[model samples]
Target: MSRRIPLPPPPPPAEIQSWPDREARLVDRALAMDELGRRLLGGRRLTLFLVWFVLLELGWSFVGVALTAFDHGQIDPITLMLVMFSTCVGLAILVPAVWMTVRGILRDRVARERLAQWAALDSHPATDARLRAPTLGLCWLLLSFAMCAVGLWISFAVPAGTSREDGGYGFVAYGMGIGLILWITGLVGLTKAVGHYRFAVRLTGRPGPRSASSGHPRPE
Candidate 1:
C-alpha cells in the first residue's frame, strides 16, 4: 500500500535569528541527523553490504543447483558435495549478515525516534532544507524500483532470448545483481524515511508550548 508522507512546513522566512548558546548547540547536534542519514543510506557501509550481498546470492544459487540436481534423480557424490558445500557456505555468510542487519535496524530505530523529535521542532528558518525534506529518500526509493525492474527484465528476458553464442547471460547477470542490491538498499531507506515522517507528524500534531513561542530560537 502507498503511504502519505508528511512534509515539514516550508522553509520558514529567512530573518535575523538569535538563541541561547546552549539551544544553538542543541540545534547543531540535531542537524547532524542529516549527516547520519546520508552515511547510513548513501555511505560506505551500504556499499560494503551490497558487495557482501552478492556472496549471499552466490550461496543461494548453489543451493538451488543442489536441489535441482536432487530433483532430477542425479543423486550421487556430486549432489552430496553440492548440498554440503551450499549448506556450509550459506551459513558462513548468512549468519553474520543477518546479525549485522538486525543490529543496525535496532540502532537506527532509536536514532529515528530522535530525528522525528528534532524534525518536529520549529527550528530557525536558516536551518538546512535537507532536514525538512524527504526528497533524498524518495529519489532513492524510485531509482531503486526502476533499476530493479530493469534488472528483472535483463535476468529473465535477455538470457532466454539471446543465443548461447552471443554470451549475453554474463551481462544480464551483472545488471540483475546491481538491481537486486539497489532494491534492498531502497527498502531500507524507505523504512527510515517513513518511520521518521510518521513520528514527526505525530509530534507536530500534539498540543504543547513549542519553543517557538518562548521568544527564543527553537531548540534542537
Candidate 2:
C-alpha cells in the first residue's frame, strides 16, 4: 500500500504577494482624483470665453456693416473690398476654433467622470453594466460633436455656384444630415454619463476628495 504521505501541508498557502502592490496603486489613484476633477471642470471658463468671443465678433461684424452702409460714398471701393474680405476670413477661422474648443471640453469632462467612477469603485464595485455606461455615453458625445463640426466645415467649403445636383453639394448635405443624427445620439450619451456619475457617487456614499475641492456642490 503506497504510504499516504500527506502532501507536505500544501506549502503554506502561497502568500498573495500582489495585494500590497495593488493596494498602493489604488491609493495613488485615489489621491489623484481631486487634481483630475479640477482639470476636467477647468474648461468651464473656456466655454465662457468662447461665448464672449462670439458676442464680440457679432458686435464687430454689425458695426462694420453699419459703417460700410453709411460710408459707402466716403470709403474707397478697394478699401471696402479688403475690409469685407478680412471679416469673412476672420469669421471662418473663429467658427472652427469654437467647434474645437467645445469638442475638447466634452472630452475632458468625459475623462474626469471616468476617473471619478474608478475611484468610487475602490470601496464599492458596481455592476459591469453600470461601470461601462458613462464611457459609452461620453464616447457618443465626442463622436457626434466631431461629425457635426466636420460636416459644417465641409458645407462651408462647398462653392456657391455648386448646385444641389452636384456631387460636392450632395456630399455636404449628406454630411450635415448624418451630423444631425450624431448630435441627437450625443445628447443621449451625455444623459448616460450624468446618470452614471450620480449613481457612482451614491455607491461611494459621498464625493471623493476631487469633488470636495472642485467647488461644485454635490448633486442633491
Candidate 3:
C-alpha cells in the first residue's frame, strides 16, 4: 500500500553558519517535512491539472449554450439532458479542489508549528529580514488577485457577442468558475509560504532550545 503521509525532510543543521545560502537551505529543509510536502498535493502537477480543468470548465459552458436553440426559446429534452450531464461532470472537479484547499490549510498550520520547533534548534538564528513573508507566497497572492479581477471583468463587462439573445456561450458564469479554482489554489500556496516564514521569524534571535535528555532537535 502507498504511504499516507510523505517522508519527512532530513534534519537541518543545529547551526546554520556553515550552510551556504542559509535562508534557501532553511526553506528547502522545511519544505521537505512531510506535512508541507503533502499540503502541496503534488505541487506543480496539481497546478497543471487545475489549469486543464479550468479550460475544460470554460469550454463546457459553450457546449451547453450550443445545445439550446434560442430561435423559438425552446429546448429539446435530449439536448437538455446531455447538457446537464456535461455540467455535472464539470462541477464534480470542485469536490477535490475544495478538499485540497481545506486539507492544505490544516496541514499548513501543522507545518508552521513544526517548522518553528525545527528552526529554534539553530544556534545562529535567522534575522527578521530573512524571515519575511516568502517571495513565492507574494506571487501566489498577486496572481490570485489578478485572476479574481479577470474573472469579474469577464463575467460582467466582457460582451459574449453582438447580442445576448443566444447567450453567446455563457462566458459570465464560466469565467467565475475558472476564477474560483485559481483562487483556491493560490490561497493555499500563499498560506503555506507565508505561514512558514512567520513561524521562522518568530524564533529569530531567541536562544536555542534543548531537551533535557538530548541536545538535538526533537523528532516529529
| Candidate number of the best TM-score | 1
What's the ranking of the predictions by TM-score, best on top?
Answer: 1, 3, 2
Q: What would the TM-score be for candidate 2 when compared with the true structure?
A: 0.37
lDDT of each: 0.50, 0.44, 0.48
Once model 3 is optimally superposed onto the true structure by TM-score, how far is the C-alpha of residue 103 displaced, in angstroms? Answer: 2.3
Provide the lowest-lDDT 10-residue window in model 2. 5-14
* Among all candidates shown, the one with the greatest lDDT: 1
Ranking by lDDT: 1, 3, 2
Cand. 3 TM to true fold: 0.53
| Model 1 misplacement above 4 A | 1-23, 120-122, 132-139, 147-186, 193-209, 212-220
Clashing pairs in 2: 34-210
In model 3, how large is the Cα lDDT of residue 104?
A: 44
- Runs of candidate 3 with Cα error greater than 4 angstroms are 1-3, 7-72, 120-145, 155-163, 166-171, 204-220
Q: Estimate each model's TM-score.
A: 0.55, 0.37, 0.53
Candidate 3, residues 125-167, lDDT tens digits: the string is 3332344435544555566556556655554553443245644
